[model samples]
Target chain A: MTIVITAFERSPDGGKGLARDTRVRWALEEVGQPYEVRLVSFGAMKEPAHLALHPFGQIPTYEERDLGLFETGAIVFHIAERHTGLLPDDANARACAITWMFAALNTVEPPILELVTARIFESDKSWSAQRMPLVEDRVRNRLGQLSRRLGDAEWLDGAFSAGDLMMVSVLLRLRASGLLDEYPNLSAYVARGEARPAYKRAYDAQLAVNKPTAG
Target chain B: MTIVITAFERSPDGGKGLARDTRVRWALEEVGQPYEVRLVSFGAMKEPAHLALHPFGQIPTYEERDLGLFETGAIVFHIAERHTGLLPDDANARACAITWMFAALNTVEPPILELVTARIFESDKSWSAQRMPLVEDRVRNRLGQLSRRLGDAEWLDGAFSAGDLMMVSVLLRLRASGLLDEYPNLSAYVARGEARPAYKRAYDAQLAVNKPTAG
Candidate 1:
């Protein structure tokens, strides 16, 4: 059965690979799965059809035969469970890997998202400058904890499971902010993730869509 | 092997069931698993010993046999996978339910978390009053989409799976903010979750810890 997933017709990031479809694409690439992408314009994403698949009207819904699913974490985890490369065979190790996935999305990403909202949406606010540090500090706090835990480690746990895939993807958004550079080990950690053959393939795939001459 | 989880020595919410341990406890209750709770103070949570178990220094870390795990989503998911109940038998339905769990933590909870930070930490800021509407509107946007999807449904999906367990937990935090009340259906949905026997047991357990006479 062919797997079909949605992507932004044009990502708000302009194909910097920060858009969530890149995460799913990277997971599929990691697992050596060939999947089809159904591009959805921003307007189409909010339409009834897309909303039916993703109630939040988000891009990157997954469909395979009779099954439909959304949420990038779920999509990546589903792909991991179906394939061999992304999860460990050991049950305890696999559960630990899944913990990192949740930590990335829930604990780590929320502060980074608050930073995004501050920079993108609330930049014009009267108190933006003063409040920026508060937002950034919260992000740094999480990164500090994460960096400490990740000391001298290659991946989050043992190998580069979906946990690392997600943690790296979440951290990539921090590059432009320069906060990620504060933690040398985390910067290297994200770089290690980017250096993966699968990550390169996924990055190039999304970049191709945003290239100058691309459709 | 005995299953042990961590909770706050004194929850900030005063045992309103907003602490993340409540979610883990509720999942255990739903699956009829008896577990022990170890309470950690705020300072102790950041200490090396506790941090070894939970990198983020937050409550609700799970330990069983040789495995130690943190992150409420991961813990709840671990319990759901190990035990009966809390998940559907159907593959597609199971995937969809997992999608809702991610949706609650990643999508629905982020804005609500922003609201929490705004109300609690940022309440004293100069821009707090003026900037609240912006933070609030983002939350309302997500809730509106969720409410539309829920419509008259008893749960986000069928049969009250872990997805509803998680989403209801996420939404429960918003009750004090009055934002949840705007969407009657969502409020009712959360109420329905609270009305569950498992949820009540979970809530009462947490409340017992915070009561004046309790140690």
Candidate 2:
């Protein structure tokens, strides 16, 4: 069965590869899986059809045969569980790798997303400037802990499993904010992830979709 | 190997069962597994010892033999995978179950956490009052979609899988906000989760740890 995933018709990031689909596409690339992408407009995303696949009406819903799944973390894990490259063979190492996946999405990403909401949604509000520091500090606190745990390690756990893939992807969101630069190891980690041939392919593919078309 | 997990020494919710450990505890109960709990103070959570187990320095962290794991979702998932009660046997159904878990943490809970931040952390800020409605609306948007998907169904998918456990746990946080009352079906769904024997045992166990000692 062909794996079909949904992506934005035109990503809000404008080809920056920050969209969740990039993460899924990257996972597929790492696992040597060829998948098809269906672009959905923001308006259509909230339609009943899309909502049936994703309760939250979000992009990057995965469909294969009779199975449908959403949530980037879950989709990535689904792909990783079936494919060998994204998970370790050792039981303990695999559990640790899975731990990092949750840590990236649950513990680390929330504060970064709060910063995004503060910047984009609340920028016009009276207290946006004052509140920005508090939000950024929250992100910094998590990053400090993450950097400390990462220490000088090349990847989060052992080799570059899905954990590193997710951690790198989550950290990439901080680059534009300059917070990632404050943590040199994390900066290098993201660079390593970007340098991967598979990551490069996924990045270019998503870019092609979001790029402006000539008249 | 003994399964040990961590919880707040004194939960901010004061035995309200909102702590992540309760979710793990409930899963264990459902699986008919007994476990030990280690209570950690807020200060200790930031220390290197706890940070080594959980980079984010939060509860509950899972330790069994040499393999230690953190992130409530990951820990709960670890337990669910080893045990039978929390997940379906069907491959597609299990994948959907995991998707709902991610949806609970990533999609639904972020806005709710923001609301918590707005109310607890940012309450004194000048923009709290003005910004709250927007935050609440974000939550309502997600809830509306969830309720639509749930319709008259007892759970997100079939049976009370980990997905329902997580979704119910996530939605439980909204009760204090009163946002849950807007959707009657969602309110009933949470009631069903709380009514489960395993959930009651889990809730009571955490309450015992958190309840103040008598003079």
Candidate 3:
């Protein structure tokens, strides 16, 4: 069955992998799965048609035959569950890998997102300057803990699995804020994730969509 | 094998079920699976012992024999995957249910959490008053879209699966804010979730741990 996923017609990030479909695309690439992308303009995303697939009216809804999945975490998880390259075979490692996936989405991503909302959506507000540091502190607090856990390690837990994939993706959001630079090991870790051939393919694919429109 | 999950020695909410363990307890109860709770004080949660299981040093963490899981979403997802009642057998429905779980955590819960941080953590900061409306508006925007999708529906999708369990859990955080009541359907939807016997069982279980001490 052909896998179809949605993406922003013009990603707000100008084709940066922050658009999340990039993660799914990367996952599919890792597993050597050929998939299709359906770009939805911002307006169409709010309409009933797209909203049915994603109640939250967000980008990156994955559809495979009758199976339609939303939430990049869940979609990536689905891909990991079905495909061979993304998850480990050992039961304990698999469970740990899944746990890391959750950590990436639920724990690590929340604070990063807070920083984003404060900087972008709330920048015009009177409180932006005052609140930015607090949000940054929270992000650093999370990164500090994560860095200690990952001390001198190659990946989060074991070998590269979907957990590392997701965690690296979550940590990448911090690049723009220059926060990841504070943790040398974490910055290097993200560099390693980006160096993966699959990640390169995914980045190039998303970048293609964002290429400057020919005049 | 017996499952051991962590919870606050005394929940900050004093048994309001805001603690992440409540979600795990609810899942176990729904599956009719007996489990044990390991209580960690606020101080203990930050210590290395707890940090080993959860890098962020928060509860609840799940341990069963050799398997240890952190993050409420991952733990709940593990339970749902292992049990039959919490998920659907149909491949598509199951995928949809998983999508709702992600939607609840990633899309819906983040804004609600921001509101909590603004009111509680940042309240003492000079920016609290000015920053609050921005946080509230972001939450309201997400809720508005969610309410539209949930119109006249009992659950997020077809039936009361883990998806509803998580969505309701996320929305419960907003109840005290009085913002949830603004949307009748969403308000009633939460009420419907609360009325479930499983929810009551879970609520009471967490409340037991949070019983106030007599002076």
Model 1 lDDT, full chain set: 0.95
- CA displacement after TM-score superposition, residue A122 of candidate 1 (Å): 0.7
Task: Identify the candidate with maximal lDDT.
Answer: 1
The regions of model 3 sitting more than 4 angstroms off are none
Residue lDDT tens for model 2, B1-215: 89999999999999999999999999999999999999999999999899888878889999999999999999889999999989999999999999999999888889888888889998898878888899999999989989999999999998999989999999999999999999999999999999999999999999999888811
Worst 10 residues of 1 chain A by lDDT: A206-215
By lDDT rank, best first, the candidates go 1, 2, 3
Candidate 2, residue A107: how far the Cα is off, in Å = 0.7
What's the residue-level lDDT of B211 in candidate 1?
90
TM-score of the B chain in model 2? 0.98
Return the TM-score for each candidate structure. 0.99, 0.98, 0.97
lDDT values, one for every candidate? 0.95, 0.92, 0.89
Give the higher-DockQ candidate: 1 or 2: 1
Individual DockQ of the candidates?
Answer: 0.97, 0.87, 0.79
Least well predicted 10-residue stretch by lDDT in candidate 1 chain B: B54-63
> Which regions in candidate 1 have their CA more than 4 angstroms from the true location?
none
DockQ-wise, the better of 2 and 3 is 2
lDDT of candidate 3 over A7-53, digit per residue (tens): 98889998778889999999999999999989899999989899888
TM-score of predicted chain B versus true chain B for each candidate? 0.99, 0.98, 0.97
Q: The CA-based lDDT of model 2 is what?
A: 0.92
